[model samples]
Target: MDENNNLTEPNDSQRNFILAIYILFALSVVFTSVTSAVGAILAYRKRDDVRGTIYETHIAYLLRTFIIALIGIILGIILSAIGFGLIIIVLVEIWYLFRVVVGIVKFAKKQPVTPTGYFM
Candidate 1:
């Protein structure tokens, strides 16, 4: 709350930053891991700035997604010896894409998102 006792929401830049992170995650699923890593780093670095604001949840969400995807990628690589790893990798990629879509849609609608979940 501000001096007027009104709620102080995140500003436009913060909002745009969230959207940008979503974009980076979405792109990373198909094109490159670099963007995802970059997005995760941004989220990690900005986590404090978003506390008590809407972006805080988004940063948490992004971090969770990044970690889950990393784990899935590793597991997929380990299982690749049996060929099941291919399936695991594809599933992880699909799951990651689905999550990115859901997150971005909810974010665009300005919905309140939970920080923890595979789905929005």
Candidate 2:
């Protein structure tokens, strides 16, 4: 809830949409950016809908996660020229999976996650 007393728990439609976004991010592991890209876009589209609710943090969290992952991937590619970029890329994927799983758990419990902080 916010200063206006909005519902903290997500409604049915919002719940489904939020979970779907998380799932999309998770699927990025196999799709390799395609799914996460779609998820990020969807999250941005939904950002205003949850404005004053706890779900707003969820959207920001997802966006932050996407940005960090993208950065890590780019850095990995750049460093790959030195033969160690694969390690950073792999770690970023694992981190992305971990964050998504944590986000899903938080969503299930109606818990608020860090919206701007890195590493969840």
Candidate 3:
């Protein structure tokens, strides 16, 4: 019984580390560059841990999202010449946001987030 209780209680550092990851994820959307950079650093530093894999996945997601956004921008510019720019941009942003949110949630929960529905 005592052993069980001890097992359930995380030490201070572990608790703080878990909270830090959550906070970093929460701030990622608003301050992506900084938050993601910090996440990447932490991920590299803790490469042997399970949490490190999550952070690494997150970093990959961030980079891919930016690449997708760039593609959207270029497409938007080309489409604007044909008068469908606004619609395409809106759709792309929505898609990008969805991928980021879903991927992060799945990572946090230790589930596999498959690339699907235009995510490549």
Which stretches in model 3 have alpha-carbon errors above 4 Å? 1-52, 115-117
Cα lDDT tens digits, model 3, 27-117, are 6556664564464456456533433333334444544555666688679878998899988877876776676667656655644434323
**Highest-lDDT candidate:** 2
Per-prediction TM-score to the true structure, in the order listed: 0.89, 0.89, 0.50
lDDT at 117 for candidate 3?
36
Candidate order by decreasing lDDT: 2, 1, 3
Give the better candidate number (1 or 3) by TM-score.
Answer: 1
- Worst lDDT window (10 residues) for model 1? 1-10
Q: What is the lDDT of residue 85 in candidate 1?
A: 96
Worst 10 residues of 3 by lDDT: 1-10
**How many residue pairs collide in each prediction?**
0, 0, 0
Tens-place lDDT digits, model 1, residues 1-108 = 112223248788889888889889988977998999999999899888777676677788889888998999999999999989999999989888877787787788
Q: Residue 17 deviation, candidate 2, in Å? A: 1.0
Q: CA lDDT of 84 in candidate 2?
A: 98
